[model samples]
Target: MTHVLNRIILTAILALFAVQANAMWIQPDWYEVTQPGVGTNRYAYSGNDPINNFDPLGNDFSKAPGDYDFSEEGAAREEAEMQNRDLDGVTDGIIIDKSIGHLSSGPGRYRSTQKYLEAVASGKIGPQNSEISRKEALANIRDLGEQFEQRSLVCDASCEAMVPGPGQTSAIGASVAVVGGVAAGTNSIPTRGKFKGSTPGTSPASIAARQAFGNTRIPGNVRLPAPTAKAPLQTSNRVGTVVGRIGPIGAVVGGAIVGTQVIRRDSQVLQCMSSCYSTGFLDR
Candidate 1:
C-alpha cells in the first residue's frame, strides 16, 4: 500500500509539471494613436520586446517600447519631431497592430493543432481551453468577412428583428468589441445599416443584434447599408460634452436619423456594450 501511494503521488506530480509545461502566456507590444490636438498626432507602442529593448511598466504603459530602428533618417527624425510636437495637440486615437511573440527553439514545443490536441488528451488542459479556442477561431473567421459573404441574409431595415414591422419586433441590436479585451476601452462596430457612430458603455443585447445580421440570410433584392464611422471617446471626462449638452443632443438626433435608415444601425451600440461588459465571454 505504501509503495502504491508513492507511485500515485509521483504520477500526480509529473502530471502537474506536464500541464504547466504546456501552458503558455505572452504579452505583446501593440500600437496606439496619440493625437496631440485636432490634427497633429503620433504613434506609441506598449508592452515588452527584447528586440525593441522595452521594460515592463507594471501597467500597460510600463511595458511600452519607445524607439524603433527607422529605415530612413528622415522618417526617424520626423517621428522624433512629432513625439512632443505642439505639446497641446489632441490625442485622437491609437492604432494597434497584432500581437507579436518571442523567439523559441527546440522542436518549437508549442506547434500545430495536433500537439494541442495531444496535450488535451494527456489531461494538460481542461475542455474549456478547447471551447475557448473554438470560439476564438469562429470569431476570427467572422472578422475575416468570409462567413458573412457566404450567408444570404437580407440587409434591409424592415427585417423583423432589426426593425418593427406588422408582426415583427422594433427594438434594434448592437455590440461593442474592445481591441485588446477589457484592458482596452469599449469600441463600437457599425451594424449592416443601423448605426453610424460609436457608443461607449453600450449594451450586450445590441452586440447580439450585430452578430445576428452577420448570420442573417438576406435576399439579393435587398441592400445592406455601409458601416458607419466610429468616433473615439475622450479618455478623460474632465474636458468633454455630456449627452444632454447642445452638441451631444445634436449628435444624438443625427445618430437616430442615420441609424433609422441603416440596416445594421444597432451594431455599434451592441458591440460597444460587449466591449464594456468587462467580464466573461461576450457571447455568454
Candidate 2:
C-alpha cells in the first residue's frame, strides 16, 4: 500500500510538470486587439480579457508599415526566415512603436523611458544578422518586456504593443483546459471497470457526454468516419451566405419583367377599345 501511494505521488508531480511545460507558450501569429481608427480601418474583432476577443481578417492598419509590401521577392525571402512566421515585422514594429509612444507620452519617469529607448535605438534585428547583433536585439526586447510588465502597459485602448490579445489569451486558456481535461481523464471513475467491453447500462448520450466533457479515451469509444458529409456542409454554409445577397437582386429583375408585361397588356387593351368605339361596335 505504501509503495502504491509513493508511485501515485510521483506520478502526480510528473503530470504537474507536464502541465506547466505546456502552459508556457502562447499562439504566435495572432493578436487580440482593439484600436481607434477610421471606419474603413476597423478590425474584424473587438474585445477585452477572457471571452469577447477575436482575430482580424488581415493585418491591423495602424500596425501596417508605410512601405510594407510583402509581394517583393526580397520581402518573401526575408519572411521565409523570421522568428515569428506570419507577423514577424508587425510584432517587432508594435514593440518598437509602443515602447516609443508609451515612453514619450508619459508625463514623468523620464529616466526609465530614456534607458529603454536607448536600448532599442540601435535599429531592429533580423534572422540574417550576426550572432552578436541578434543577442543584443533580444536583450533590448527583454528589457522592454520587463518595463511593460512593471508598468502593466501590455493592454491599452490601442493595444499595439507586445501584449497578449484575445488570440494569445485563448491559446493560454486552451492549453490550461487541455491539461485539466487530460488530468481529469486520468483520475476519472467512469473510464474504469466494465467500460472496456459491452456497455451494459450506459445510454449513448451519457457515454458521449462523459467522453466529451470528461475527456476520456476509454476502449470501444471509437468515432466513425464521415468523409462524404464534409463537402455538403461546406457547400451549405456558402449557399447560406450567398442567399440573402441574391434575394434582392432576383426580386428587382422579376419586378421589372412583370411591370413591363403589365404595361404592354394594358396598352393593347386600350387600343382595341378605342378602335371598337371608332368603328361603332358598341351601338351594334
Candidate 3:
C-alpha cells in the first residue's frame, strides 16, 4: 500500500512540472512584430511576468485600473495648444492690419483728392482745353465725386474707435461708434449733392423734369409753367446719402460687438488654463 501511494505522488509532481514548462515555452496568441526589441520573442508575455501582468491582445500589456495615460493626454493637449497659438497669431495679425488700414485710409483719400485738385488747377487735366477730351473730363469729374462719396463713407470718428484695444469695453467702443455715426450723418445731409459747388437741384432727374416742363406748350398760344427742380422720393442721391451715413455706423457697431465676443472667448480660454494649472491638470 505504501509503495503505491509514493508512485501516485511522484506521477502528480511530474505532471505539474510538465505543465509549468509548457506554459513557460508557449508562444503568445499574437505578437507585436512591428515593435523593436521584444517583438522577436514570441514566447515573452507581459514582460515575462504572467502572474501579475496580463496582455490579452499579446501586443502590449494593459495598464492597471485607475492608471492615467499621461503620454497620450499630454500629446493631445499639446496639439490643442499649438492650434490655439496659431489661431491667436492669425487673429492678432488681422487686428493689426485692420487698425493700420483704418488709420491710413482717411488721410490717403484726402491726399489723393488734393493731388487731383492740384492737377486740375494747374491745367494738366480739366474740362477746358487741357490734356483730356470733353467726355474724359466729364468722366473724371464724376470719378472725383465718387471718390468724395467713398471718402465720406469712412471719414468718421467711429473709424478710430471701432476697434477697441486691450482692456477696453465693447460698450465704450459702440457708444463712440454711434456718436461718430450720428455726426457723420448730420454732416452728410447738407452736403449730400454739393460736390465742388454742385447743388441738390442739379441732379439729372431734376434737370430733365425742369427742361421738359419748360418746353411744354399748351394749344392756343398757352405756355406751361416750368416746374421747380425737386428731387424724387427715391432718387439715387437721396438714397446714397442715407445709406452712406447709416452703413458706417452699423459697421462700427457690428465690429465692436464682434471684437467683444472675441475678447470674451480669449478670456474664457485664459480662465480655463488658469483653472487647469491650479488643479494640477496642466504644468506651469
Candidate 4:
C-alpha cells in the first residue's frame, strides 16, 4: 500500500510539471518593456499612440523614413495648394488647365468655388488667395449699391430719398455706386434740372446750401431720379418767393395755381422723382 501511494504522488507531480511547461506565457504589459533606443515608446500604430516628435510617450521610436517623408510631402502639398489658391481671373469659363487639389492652377473660371464666392461677397481678398470675375467684383459694388438703396428707403422726405424738391434745392440722385466701393457723398449730387434755373421752387435755405456746395459734381452711374410733384406751399412760402410781399392778391392766385397743378400732379407716381425727367415721365 505504501508503494502504491508513492507511485500515484509521483505521477501527479509529473503531470503538473507538463501542464506548466505547455501553458502559454502572457506578454509583460508591452509598455513595461524598455525601449530599444532614446525616443518615444513603441506600441502598435493606432489612435492611442499618436505620432508626435516631442511627445514623451509618442510611438514609432525607430523614426521610420516613411513617416518623415510623408510629413514633408504633406506640408509641400499644402504649400502648393495655397500658392495656386484663387478665383480664376479669366472669365471665359473654360478649364484650360487641370486643377490640383482645389487649386486654381489653370486659367479657368473660379477654381475654388467657395473662395471665389467669398471674394465676390467681400472685395477684401485678392488674386493671390482667391480670384473673382470683374463682373463679380462689380456685382459686389452693386450689392453695396443695393444696400445704399435700402438705406435710402429709410429717408422720410422726398429730398432725402433723392427725389427733387419743388425748387432749386437739388436733390441727390438715387443709388450712386462707384468703382472700388468708394462712393461720393450724397450731398454732392445736385437736384438741379433744366427748369431749376427758371421756375424752381427752391427755399432760400436750400439755395444757400446749394451755393455753399456748388463746386462738387455728381458721380457717374448714379441714375438721376425723375421729377415728382412738389408739395403744396403756403402763400407766404411759395418757393422762397414772398408773393405776399410782391402782390398779396396775386399770391392767392399763385398758391391756387400751385396747389391745383404742380403740387397735385404726380405725388405718388413720382414720389422720389421729378417733373423734368426727360428720359421718361414715369419717375420709376
Clashes of 2: 2
TM-score of each predicted structure versus truth: 0.14, 0.19, 0.18, 0.16
What is the C-alpha lDDT profile of model 1 across 1-284, one tens digit per residue? 33433432332222222222221111222211231112200111101111121112212321222222223553355345433322222222212111111112211111112222333345444444333343443344344233222211221112224433321121221111211122122223344444323343232332433443344433443433322235343322211121111122333444343334332322222222212221221111
Candidate whose lDDT is highest: 3
Candidate 4 lDDT, 108-161, residue by residue in tens: 112133233444445444445544544565554455335433432332233334
Clashes of each: 45, 2, 0, 15
Error of 1 at 133 (Å): 19
- Better TM-score candidate (3, 4): 3
Cα miss at 29, model 2 (Å)? Answer: 4.8
Q: Model 2, range 1-284, lDDT digits (tens) per residue?
A: 33432432342223222222232211112222232332221111111111011112223423333212233553454344332322213333322223231222211122223333333345333434323343454565466445433322222212222222333434434433443333334222443454311232142323333454354342365432111112322221221122222222323443344334433332233223223222321111
Judge candidate 2 against the unseen true structure and give its global Cα lDDT, from 0 to 1: 0.29
Considering lDDT, which of the candidate structures 1 and 3 is the better prediction for this target?
3
**Model 3 RMSD, rounded to 1 decimal:** 40.9
Provide the overall lDDT of each model, using Cα atoms, as 2-decimal numbers: 0.26, 0.29, 0.32, 0.29
lDDT for each residue of candidate 3 in 1-284, tens digit (9 for 90 to 100): 33432432342223222323332322222223233223222222112211112222222321222111235553355334323332113322221111111111111122222333344445544444233344543455465445433432332222223443445456545544554354344433334445311344443333333343344333355322222224233223232232233334544664566455444433333223222222321110
Those runs of model 1 whose alpha carbons end farther than 4 Å from true positions after fitting are: 1-256, 260-268, 271-273, 281-284
Runs off by more than 4 Å, candidate 4 = 1-131, 134-136, 139-247, 271-284
**Model 3: residue 49 alpha-carbon error in angstroms:** 47
Stretches of model 3 off by over 4 angstroms after superposition: 1-243, 279-284
